[model samples]
Target: MFEIKDNHLAAGDLLAEALAKVPGIRHVKEVNDLSDIDKPTATPCLFYLYYGDQLTDAANAGANMQLKQTWLVVLAERKGSKQAGTNITATIRAIAGKMTGGAGPWQRVNTPIKPKYTNGHAFYPLAFTCQMRFKGALK
Candidate 1:
């Protein structure tokens, strides 16, 4: 068995900081912070990240020592529904660009699907996933 200790916290922090640069964004929160909020505020905009999973490749012996970690990113803009999709999609694209250009700490292993608007929500919400590879010691 192998244990992979990926820098998920650090990665999420960096990603959030990057997103905070988007204009009108009042909230750059983590899932942990969301959990503590009894009543969420109608902030101008908000984004949060949740840790996903770490899975290793069992087929390859070498791959067993490493794992792929994923994060679920949620974006919401309460000000304008029409502009919500555009805002979230642009932010996602910016994150992707950072990965390809080596602007971030971890390698972005996967690309998020195009962001779309959702119904039945007070804010225009979009969800996406980000993946990163993590190496660990083999035993």
Candidate 2:
């Protein structure tokens, strides 16, 4: 059997690394809450969280497992500047481009959500999913 925690960490790390390379993204982290995000330091940042998982298939009397895991990535940028919208759009496309080729194990499951403007910030959420398959018994 495979360790789920390790897989989760690897997947999250992979995404974080990829997003970090995107232009205009200054910070990338796994966040528990959006309300507490610091706009100044983390603006033009990407925050991701593991949403949930589902078992899609199983075989070999439980020795093999196929699971689908989902993650949510939020892009936060400071609003007010005329280029804020343009920057957001560029970042979105860059992110989508990164996801288009497929990372180690993660895939962009759906289109990014519309940006929500509030409190001098614009937030765009993107969803990604991955399929994890574990076969054989643990050592």
Candidate 3:
């Protein structure tokens, strides 16, 4: 998942498009339901990645790049439990690399709070943290 200024689904969608190269990512989904009392306020922007073997393939392709701090969400299916953690971390790094075109002196903005995972039972989701700086409205 890509971090957008607003934390909205649109941003997540855009991120999905930008990260189209990732393999095994069967699909990207926007989750807006906040019924969980423990759930944090939904960022105006966010996306969840549904990954598979293809995701591994895609991540391996981008392993050789340098990426700056970036936000991402990795959702592994129940069956793919074995590789969930590693795949998520690697995929985020790969997406960040691809988004920045493998080169960046991107200014970093430390998030006041660390991004974390929620709905731990089956989803196995993890959120990302990245430094953000802004001068204009993020599209």
Question: Which is the leading candidate under TM-score?
Answer: 2
lDDT agreement with native, every candidate: 0.50, 0.65, 0.38
For model 3, the local distance difference test gives 0.38
lDDT of 2 by residue, 17-91 (tens): 767776766788887665555464757777887777778888888777878667788777777656566655655
Give lDDT tens digits, candidate 1, residues 1-139.
1122554455566667677777656666677643342234654456565545555454345544334445555555443456766666666665653642222433344434443333433333344333444454455
The whole-model C-alpha lDDT of candidate 2 against the native structure comes to 0.65
Candidates' RMSD to native: 5.8, 4.1, 13.3
Q: Name the TM-score of candidate 1.
A: 0.57
Best by lDDT: 2
**Model 3, 1-139: lDDT tens per residue?**
3332453223344455544545555555444432232332322122443221112112334542222233335343444356555555555554543434222322223323333445532343444332222223223
Candidate that beats the other on TM-score, 1 or 2, i.e. the better one: 2
Q: Supply the TM-score for candidate 3.
A: 0.40
Backbone Cα, N, C clashes tallied per candidate: 0, 1, 10
Clashing pairs in 3: 7-43, 7-44, 7-45, 8-44, 8-45, 23-54, 23-55, 24-54, 24-55, 109-131
